[model samples]
Target: MNPWVRLMSKNVANICIMLILPLVFIIIWFYLAKSIDNTVILPSPAMVLQLLSHPSENLISMGSLTNNIFISLLRVLAGYILAVMLAIPLGILMGYYAKIFQLFNTFVGLFRPIPPLAWVPLVLAWFGISSFATLTGVERGILFIYLNNIKLSMVFIIFIGAFYPVLTSAIYGVKNVKKTLIDSARVLGASESDIFFKILIPAAKPSIVNGMRIGLGVAWMCLVSAEMLPGSLSGIGYLITHAYTIARTDVVIAGMISIGVVGALMDTLFRIFEEKKFKWQRLIR
Candidate 1:
């Protein structure tokens, strides 16, 4: 048997198994909708599909589906990127310097247990609840209007939510690098910067990637919560909240499915990159 063929067959089988539960769920949903005669409580899969197809019209006054999704994606990316930029260097330092870790460990320990959504009230209070028009100058244009205090607050919330996982993972990754390896590089007359850039970072790539994946998932969760706030006017979370208020269960479901699909897609892409870029890690494992 050819190895490539065998791998392809295995992948196909896994995909089929992955799809079975969703198919069964849809079937049960359809049956319940017909049997219960209550679209409000349990909309058929078809109803949700109809709403998804006409998202521009059905998404509760929130622009088109594309616009809402793009907004959410942008917020998540902005916060996630900021979190990564801050976490990696700081985390590396914490791991490399015992004194630095000792100084920050108390703060990290205090904050780690707090859920991101718990900060929502504080964030809203700090940023103010003014309308975008009232907050910004008209000369700043639509982009500035869209990125008003409310949106900045949401991004900040997401950054806090995403920061811990990446930071902790990076610290763990750097700490776990073998002391022997560092000693060997130093013995070879390698500078501290050379040791870190060449030895520590490369060895820790897998852990860093894992941290990014976890942070991204948390970031999405934070984005949804932020968008559901009273001042928020767009995004999938806002669409879900708005639809629920109007008793549009189908629209709510559609928004949820959209979020799940987008999250899954992003994770899948990251996984592909990890597998390709870290092939050596797999071989070692």
Candidate 2:
């Protein structure tokens, strides 16, 4: 069999096999819902599907389900992009320059372990009602007035959640490039700019991709948590919270499922790009 054909067939088979577990899970979920006798505690898959089918009607108060998802996606993209922009350069500097690494190592070490949720209170306090009102010159204590502007707070939290993973991974990736490779490029009279961009970055592509994958997941999680907090009126997390408040567990479940599906789709796209971008690595292997 041709190698490319075999690879394609193997991937298809793996996907088919992987799908079975989710189907099994759905079956178990259906059985559990039937046995539990409480729709509020655990809505059936059918009930969730029903809500999903008419998401506009079900989620009208929070805007349509599509709108909520779009809002969340925007937040995730904004934060993740910001994180990547800052992390990549800083990571490269840290990895290539010992002084830079020493300067940031202690700070990164101290804060990297802190959960994104822990920062929520601080974020809210900084960018919440008071901050918004102050910035916009609106009088304080006006309810629902500054709610929309709090999107920045959510974006920042998501950035914090995503930043460290990419930074650390990128730093490691750059550092892991064999010193001999750099030395070789130097000996060949390649300029520092050429060596760094042409040699270092290409070699670190896989690690950087891995970091981005992880960071994207973390960014999504942080977006949800941030949106669930006070002042958030839109996004999937807000939809979930609103549904729960109204005893609409089905909507909550649907929202959760939407997050998972969208996250998986984004990851799949990223993986495809990674594969195409680094196809040469496979040939080398």
Candidate 3:
């Protein structure tokens, strides 16, 4: 076959394979809904699709679906970014220096096993309904409303959820670096700074990126649970909770579908970057 034609054929085949399971799932869902004959218990796929089709349409009195999703995205990023910023450097140092690792390892190990939800009681007591608005002293106007929606407790929960995987991964990556690489750099008269940044960081970039991808997924997963905390007024998570309260199964399903789609898209972006930037890692394996 011609190269172009072969490439097109391969792409088409991959797309078809990707879609097969979802088509089967929808068919099964349609029949299941028909048999159940209860919109509250099992809404038809069409009902969910209708809500998804009109993404901007308001759900109940909270806000539009898209608006809720956007709010949730912001919350996830707020905590996820904090995790990356703190975890990477700390993890790198801990992995690189024996004393630093010894100093913090016991404390980290003590807290690492605790689930994010387990912190709810303490987090709530610490932050209550306080938000960015409270911290920044923004009392009124559009910004206040936006900032107030982001409760500190929620962010802390998400940070906890995302922190460990990233921290562990960065530590592992840096510690596992070939000793020869550092030795060679030292023999070449490289400064401590040069060896640290030029050798350690570059060698560990792939592992750190992989950790980031996992952290993002964890952070996103924490969203609904975080939003369920006190003072949450809007977000897809809250929307789903509210829909359930009113027996809006269709809306609940739609919210779930939105979360799945968003998470998959985010994962896909990470996968693409991994494949493109770390192709050598694959080849070496």
Candidate 4:
């Protein structure tokens, strides 16, 4: 086949896999919905679509929705980013250092049992219904999601989580790395930082990206629940709650659809990052 034709074929296949599959399922869902006739509880796909067609009657025009959503998005983003930043470094350190793992493993064991929601009252009790409460509330909140989710969150609480796996695999990936490469650079007297940015991270990029991709998905899934905490009036979670109060099932469904769209968008962005930035780290093999 011509190169252009081959690429087009691949693109078509990807479209089918990524989009058509969902559409097929949705068609099935619509048919089933019509058969059930329980529009009150499980509205038909058509009903939901009709609801979506209705103009949004938001009370708080520009800033209200923006502020609310921004507040909620910021909270979740802050929590997740803090997690990725704090956890990855700790994971790297603990994975490399046995002593660090032993020291922190006990704390992980202690807190791992607790649910994030369990911290809500205490967070409110201690921090009140202000910003601080919402933020720290999630340190425990997003933890469980990322905890059961991927190795990154687990290691923050303990040593062996992703620490060992990531560390050990990283070491293995590095073992194959030519010793002479680092030795030559060291013989040239490159600073430790140079070696890390130049060698360690690049060499271990594959494993690192895998861990990150998993963690990102987990964190995104946790967004709605994390926003369910009090004092957040902007996110899709808050929107859903607000709509439910007035029995606006359409709005509630719309909020949920928005959440789903955001989740899918995040996933798509991650894939784009993987394809563009981390092509070398792609785990296709």
Best by lDDT: 3
In candidate 4, what residue range of length 10 has the lowest lDDT sum? 151-160
User: Clashing pairs in model 1?
Assistant: none
RMSD of 1: 2.4
lDDT preference between candidates 1 and 3, better one: 3
Q: What's the CA error at residue 112 for candidate 4, in Å?
A: 3.5
* Clashes found in each candidate (C-alpha, N, C closer than 3 A): 0, 0, 0, 1
Summarize candidate 4's per-residue lDDT along 96-210 as a digit string, tens digits: 4568767876775576456555555555565443454333444456553332222222112222122333333443444445567778889999987887679766765666665
lDDT of 1 by residue, 1-285 (tens): 899999999999999999999999988888999999898898888888987787667356667777788878887887899999999898888988999999999999999899888888887888655433454554476766566533667787889989999999999999999999999999999999999899999998888889999999999988878787766888888878888999989888988899998999999999999999999987976
Candidates sorted by TM-score, best first? 3, 1, 2, 4
User: What lDDT does the true structure give each of the candidates?
Assistant: 0.85, 0.85, 0.95, 0.56
Task: After superposing candidate 2 on the true structure, give the runs of residues whose Cα lies further than 4 Å from its correct spot.
Answer: 1-15, 58-60, 130-150
Assess the local accuracy of residue 68 in candidate 3 as a C-alpha lDDT between 0 and 100: 96
TM-score against native, each model: 0.91, 0.87, 0.98, 0.68
Candidate order by decreasing lDDT? 3, 1, 2, 4
RMSD each, Å: 2.4, 4.1, 1.0, 8.0
Q: Pick by TM-score: which candidate is best?
A: 3
- For candidate 2, list the clashing residue pairs, or say none: none
* Model 3 stretches astray by more than 4 angstroms: none
